[model samples]
Target chain A: MPIYEKHDYPLVDVRRYLEPGPVVLLSSAHNGETDIMTMGWHMMMEFTPALVGCIISPANHSHELVRASGECVINVPTLELANQMVDIGNSTGTRIDKFKEFGLTPQKGTVVSAPMIGECFASFECKLANGKMIDEMGFFVWKVIKAHVDKTVTAPKTLHYRGGGEFMVAGDSLDLSARFKPEML
Target chain B: MPIYEKHDYPLVDVRRYLEPGPVVLLSSAHNGETDIMTMGWHMMMEFTPALVGCIISPANHSHELVRASGECVINVPTLELANQMVDIGNSTGTRIDKFKEFGLTPQKGTVVSAPMIGECFASFECKLANGKMIDEMGFFVWKVIKAHVDKTVTAPKTLHYRGGGEFMVAGDSLDLSARFKPEML
Candidate 1:
């Protein structure tokens, strides 16, 4: 369905629904071309071997780049860089150079051919263990080989998604028992 | 290895990151008792079969619960329901009646025995996909068997996580062109 009239089902943009950490714009060099796209659509899924998952569509420019490069970086962004995030999300590499347009720093990562954004708070250098995609919504399954983070600022006080062109930084954390029960912290 | 202290590393509560569609409180019902906890740790790993990745600790009361049940009801929630989200996060089913105490309504799911939350916006019935996890952060890998979003709340806005004790909600979606570029959209 190209467009549903009246959207009689939940049709919220999923991009806005994901706001866990600084969303890293994954920059990948594939077939001699580089493309980056904002992703909050990633997660850690398993424990025995530390498996992680992220979704991307086959049509996405980054999809081809990642496949060619066989890897990508999960950059964690801060709220100070939300505008850049928006720009990356809004623009596409096929039309314009996202690096030049957004002025994001592209640095070489340790393990993967995909470069990491130096501006991100952290980076996860990931390898494509396997991939499966849904036709209606493009989602990618991934596995993480190595990951890293920065804690210069309060790391946990990061981005939160609010629907409708809205985003919220985390409110001050309250220890449930300490604040409410007066016994546990 | 036991106590991972964040020196200059980004540390976050994994529970706080799941952008809320379903706060899948998966657990194992053992010995005729139930133990359930909230999960915002899941993300779409794949699009085709809808593979998901999430974190569950061996020490968590719900850990053993997952081992026993091997199935779960991904109870969807809303921003107005944030308090309930935290309520389940804080109170462990290990010692108390989590469902009754939280005023949760359990409805029969089409695929899984784990009851769906009637009040929430969506439900994804899931089964365990046996897989290995990463070594650094022990997590779990699973797949969604079926999903049910409330047909009544088409385009329902809601909240989700980035870091800390915060949650984010869905926002208005822009034209596909606005989100991407002319070429990709």
Candidate 2:
């Protein structure tokens, strides 16, 4: 039998443990200004329309742009972008143009005004699904309109934020599809 | 300069690429019945007060339980429980007792009525923060009141769901703490 022990710890750091998905670059545009911000707090909210929920603090520059524009591009960066992502996350976009500072290529999107980061393995064009909880919770719900992936990189090593400048990159993939129900597949 | 090509893909399966953190077991109890369900679709929503957002489909039995009780335990399971986690996820708690069948010890939580899985590395007692979009969005907002983590394990390997039955285990951690501003530390 395995023994478990309990310890008192700060709950604020729990995000380091439970955040489920990879850190993403949220690019927003409004009034001809485009900015990319590093984001780790987001999740898939629904399946059919492919809704996504993300929490962007009111303090973030991207928050203002996303709120004003009602659209953003979610760029999925690999482990190679770790340093740039940290730089993007650490600095305020209000003071600097992230695209030019980071030397990232911004590609035009077909659906939204937000430009996708060319270095990322995939990008999702999303429109604000709902903004009801934005004022109170800093929560923005987005619905994916179009998705673009680089088919050349079959398996991308994406960075997973583990809080406090730490990250875990995706390793080998294991298949357990046989254990699931047919409907789930 | 890096070249990126655009390829149209199914938007629904984007979770395969973006899922960032560890898969969790959401345990709920209501009407004298308890259920443990495997969940990967969750994200950290806020910092202070520690809010989390999770999408529980209206079809799952645990969803009904969580809705009725307004409280649950978010259990963070390590890679060891990956198989059992899938089995529990595949099977509905409506027909059988998940606690007994999965051989997961049900431990009383300090803040919520739901039991925590003893085998898990960490457990968070969460109370439903808001249910405004329960019907329309299947999204639940939770506030962590109490948390329990196994103190013995310094670095536990956690599982990240990659859609279908594939998972990416939390691998080596990299420290980029020097790159960030002091306040971000």
Candidate 3:
């Protein structure tokens, strides 16, 4: 596993990694117990306050930890962690310590207690901004307070899940900066 | 522009295209007017009811149309329509007729009055499932009632947006079906 050398990233620009819609590893800690889960259902809600909305079903153990702690680290993993990602999704957190099970290093976060995966390219530390929809739909509105990103790794080969164990790898980037209006960019 | 020969697609399986987190074109119609917008902030919320949650800011012209009609078509556009998608996002419907200006054909939807983009690979007709978050967050939860897909276009070159006019194109697939537990799939 490659331990990423990360640096503090701008909160408003966190959407650069997340808005693309890649599968992320969500890590949470509550009552001295830590857990990690693979999440795919998430979207960027706001840019300035850096709000993100995602569904964390009650069926997963990490959901309980996240609900209790009200904080989590959304870690963006690249294709290098595909096997571990699939395994994490398949197995429950209750049965095993995901970090130890997958040989992933847990790095202490700056703003949250939830540990960040050292191998991932980027990790956004978040606090629950709104929990009104949690009971009704397992939806959590998060405000990212801090972000850590590996600046050296541009165009990370992130994995996008398509269900049934199939993943789409991130490909070549198309820069259309010239086409976009100044305000739009 | 290629007008795909689309067939009825299963509503429960709509996540196959959406979950990957591609930039989608949202088409809306209200009264006698129709509008289209490029949207990147959206996610699949459920499978059985085919629930999808997306942020349509009040500032967008499509917001009022969708709010009044309580319906919209979520069209999945491939790389071929990238220019049109950006142009639609840059220009306002109040200033110009998008369909006529862009020269894109609009097809009548079976479940909703919102016209689907003919040049797109797939379209999902949706009705407002929940609107409680509309005022607070411009969030709308939609139930996909009908879906149309081009079966021949396997591995469509979908576009995933990163801020600053950069897009990540969908790449090769990694099928790990054997690794997934049957029940989980």
Candidate 4:
């Protein structure tokens, strides 16, 4: 396992790690209880306020924790953490401490109580920006207040889930900056 | 470009192609005018109804067309269409007919008036399920009524956009189905 020395990253630019649709580990804490859940259904909603929208099924243990505390950390796990990611999703937080069982180091966040997974290369601290659709759609809009990313890893081999326990690993990057309009970039 | 012989696909399983967060081409038509736009901010919201949530800025020409018609087609394009995808995003549909300008074949959808890009490997016909968040957040919830996929292309080399005109191409797939619980799979 690689030691990820993460540093403070711009909140507005968190989309660079998130927009590509990598499966993320959502860590939440409330009343001294902590949980981690694998989340694949999420999208970047805004740039300035750094908003994100995701579906957290009420059936998950982390749902209650996040709803009660109104905060969570979105951790981007690379291919190296694939096993731990699947294990976290398969297991339940109600039964055991995920951080301890999975052997993941939980570091305290700067703004939120949810601990960021130290093994992950990038972690974004988020607060619930809107919960209006939670009841109807199991949807939560989050505002990323603080972001931490390991600048050493330029092209992180993130995992993108494709149902049935299959994942598409991040691959070659194409720099099409010259093709884009100045304002568009 | 490879000719895609797409066939009818299960609506509930559309998440297999979408969950990975690939850049998609959104095609819409209203009042005999059609437009195509590159969309990166989207996610699968549900399985049963095959719901998908996406952010389409009001400034985009397709927004008005989709809002008025309440229909659109989510087309998944492979690396072959990278140039076209960036071109679509950088250019606007307001001035010219995107289908003709980009030389993309437009096929009439079965359920909706919106035309699906014939060149893309897959296309999902969608109906606006919820427009409540459109005014405030440029959010649109769509219910996929029909799906068409090209069965030959097993692992699609889809493009995942990062900021600054950089894209991470879809790479090697890892099958961890054996690790998953039967119910989870």
What is the RMSD, in Å, between candidate 2 and the native fold over all Cα?
Answer: 12.1
lDDT of 3 at B66: 98
DockQ of 2: 0.32
TM-score for candidate 1? 0.60
**Residue B22 local lDDT, model 4:** 99
Q: Worst 10-residue stretch by lDDT in candidate 2 chain B? A: B1-10
Give model 4's DockQ, 2 decimals: 0.92
How many clashes in each structure? Answer: 44, 6, 0, 0
Off by over 4 Å in 2: A1-20, B1-20
For model 4, residues A86-168, the per-residue Cα lDDT tens digits are: 99889864758899999999998899999999999999999999998999999999999999999998999999999998999
Residue B125 C-alpha lDDT in model 4: 98
Model 2, range B98-168, lDDT digits (tens) per residue? 98998788888766889988888677788999999899888898887776765465445778776656677
Q: Which candidate ranks first by DockQ, i.e. highest?
A: 4
Model 2 lDDT, residue A171, Cα: 73
The lDDT, on a scale of 0 to 1, for candidate 1 is 0.54
Of the two candidates 1 and 4, the one with more favorable DockQ, higher being better, is 4
Per-model interface RMSD values are 8.0, 6.5, 0.6, 0.5
lDDT of 4 by residue, B1-185 (tens): 66588999998889999999999999999999998999999999999999999999989999999999999999999999999999999997475989899889989889999999999999999999999899999999999999999988889999999998999999999999899878888
Output the worst ten-in-a-row residue range by lDDT, candidate 2 chain A: A1-10
**Candidate 3 C-alpha error for residue B48, in Å:** 0.9
- Please give, for residues A1-185, the per-residue lDDT of candidate 1 as tens digits: 01101111111211222334334567777665667887656654543344445667675778777876677766666566667776677664475667677777666666777777766656666677655433333544455555555434333334433223444554433223322222211
Error of 4 at B181 (Å): 0.5
